[model samples]
Target: MKLDVELPNPQNLTEEFEWTFPVGTVNENGDAVITSTDKSPAKVKFKDVIGSQRVTLKTKLGGRTLQESVFNVQVAYNKEVKTVYFAAKGGNIMAVKVDKNKTPEMTIKPYDMGVKSGQHPFNIFFNDSSLYVLDCGRQFTYINDETTQNMGDGKISVISYDGKKVETMLTNVGGYAFYDPFYGYLNAAEKKLYFSDRVSGFAAISLDARNQTMSRSNFPYFVQSNRLGYYGKTMMYTSLNSAFEFVDGTWWWAKINSPTGVFRFTNADILSKEATAADPEPAAGVVFKNLVIKSFVVDVNAALVHVVENSSNALYSVPLDDTILKAIAKVDDIKTYKIADLPIKAEGTSAEPVSITQLILDKETGYVYFGLCSDDETLYKSGLYQYDPVTKTLTPIVEGMGVYGVAINNAKSKLF
Candidate 1:
């Protein structure tokens, strides 16, 4: 069998080709025969090869071989096991191949999927072969113009792992008035996406539909219909600060204002056709009277929930008991347990404490990663850190970039 290879030559320079074959398949001179036709396309001829085989072709330009352009031809068995995808605040989605020993190998970029810059991908959820991206659009300028007022007209989109296709599942959503979509959860079982909007409220969208618009009434709230106006009475919780999936498939969300505490709601409660005020209030517990929760993650294996206090950078965890996890209870029914305070100062300086913006737990590795950023004009302490709950030790991973979110592919032992 013969295979023709065309190496890209933007400069149109003359190139030499070297071909390598599987062991025991070479000619008597121990070299694979490669021929060039008219100093252009190179051809490799294979003789008496049986099962599967691999051939590699290398091109030399100016007597120097091009390392990156080496092409490999596989007879049959070519497969990829795992992939990791993550997004940044400035609307960049990156895909990487998991490499255990070293840093991940980045495979695709934003441009490859037709995603323009400045889209502000706040959070991402990955299933088997696709990534669910929450694009919060550009920050809202509040300029009273249509474009500015609708700056945060966000959407939930899904991009193929290979970056070959993109589909918008929902669009023209609210929630960019204050900040990016703060938290997002994908209920794969129910084919729904639940997200928190600082300005609008907590809402869920059915992934089964395309380009669906979510209104404030589509959320789960504790308020009444008289206050909701023409939207009608719906279960919409506007005070939600953050939310996480519980062990039993329900959801727990933290509130930002009065009755400040975490609340739990089930799929049944959200899907129920009830009035806004008549709708069951989120089963509340673990209340923090005056503290604002920035983010949280559920450690299912440990039966614990780690919460981050937005202002003080204080870490707290509460047990997943009936008081907090199963049924609704009063603030006094559950207690807030203090965990180790996150390290907010620079390595050797007594700088102002950096604020923690996000948190994620790798249940497999027992490592909790958080992102930090400072507001002081004179001090800028921003980076990613790993916290070991067992040792109560916090270690800095890398500094400078204000990492707002982190995700982990536990099956592949990869973090992003």
Candidate 2:
């Protein structure tokens, strides 16, 4: 879009001009060619358009929008918005533009899913243009007794990337809750959704599209029955904090907190016989003990898991050997890096790290992303950031607000 206006007084050009876009379209920061003189027109890059549309331009006073003068123009699409979505404080889900090389980005409230935000969107994972959010809602104060049937509002929900559709999928969250499900992962290969609970290692949800009997409240799930068998028809306790896929029916779990470490198990052994966390010979679960990890993501091809320790300044790693990945009954692999040593840049000042809340990875690019919380505004600003494992580089993509979980959405069609 180009603009040219006549000005009787050169001083009139000192006032700010604001552009009002049409409805159903989104505008990001620009690639506009600006000039002080009125003789030449200014070119402004625009946003999402289906085919062609009309727009308007307006004037501003001290950051306030004045009366708008309507105008019509044919517009086209801006197709290259690689978006980053975050589960923020106060149940807000945020979307913003980003790039691969750690480019600084900006976002506004309008970028959210056009629907009411979740209560405490603890963590999120994106797939096929939909965001799977694990919210710890109800102020994190609501605790259901052991006899309860539902996990309530503080569970999983799905939201489309463009905010066109939403579904709350927490109807049959498997009985009681010693605590809420804090983090989760979607297993597309197995057609299941798994989440980590404080008391019961974790729980599962079936996303099998072929099942006609599946409903909102009667979904079949299994928690650890005893220490050995995991296919318990009802609820039992498992003390794993988080779970991630290793390969096929095999999985890796982090400790819930007592004796910290990771656990590995396969479905063949879990359902084949009874098992317990303390079993020595015929156990369904295997432990790689002693390291405390709250959340982690597995790199299937690399044979490694990127781990985040609770309240620590470092990021640790656990490697797997192909020969004994699922074959071994016990395991041990630990590597650490001081991830907090990298300062977060804000307003031209470098801020020190305060705390890390969540962690996720982009499988397509192999880039890691996480949410950081800041207590002091001047020292640091909370927002989304990315870490390049290959380059050992950290970049603050966007800052100024606290976020709980973050996910990457490559198909950001709303702004295209």
Task: State which candidate has the highest TM-score.
Answer: 2
Q: List candidate 1 segments past 4 Å from native.
A: 1-84, 95-120, 140-151, 173-182, 208-240, 244-249, 257-259, 267-286, 317-357, 374-381, 396-400, 413-416
Scanning candidate 2 in windows of ten residues, the lowest lDDT window is 345-354
Per-model TM against the reference: 0.57, 0.65
lDDT of 1 by residue, 1-416 (tens): 45455667798777777656554344444465543323333334334332224456676876777873333332211223234344533434543333223323322111112343235454667765666777655542222334543445667777765556788776654533533344577777878777765534455777656655544544444322123221132213334355455447565655554334455555444432333544344443243444556577878788766777654556767675555544324333233466655544332111211135457777775667665543431443455556777776666554444445555444442212
RMSD per candidate (Å) reads 10.1, 9.1
Q: Write the per-residue lDDT of candidate 2 for residues 2-87, one digit (tens) a residue.
A: 56654344444344554544444432354332222233334554433232234455655455656766554433224464667787
List the pairs of residues colliding in candidate 2: 201-238, 227-275, 227-276, 228-275, 228-276, 229-275
Q: Against the true structure, whose lDDT is highest?
A: 2
Alpha carbon lDDT of each predicted model: 0.50, 0.53
lDDT of 1 at 119: 55
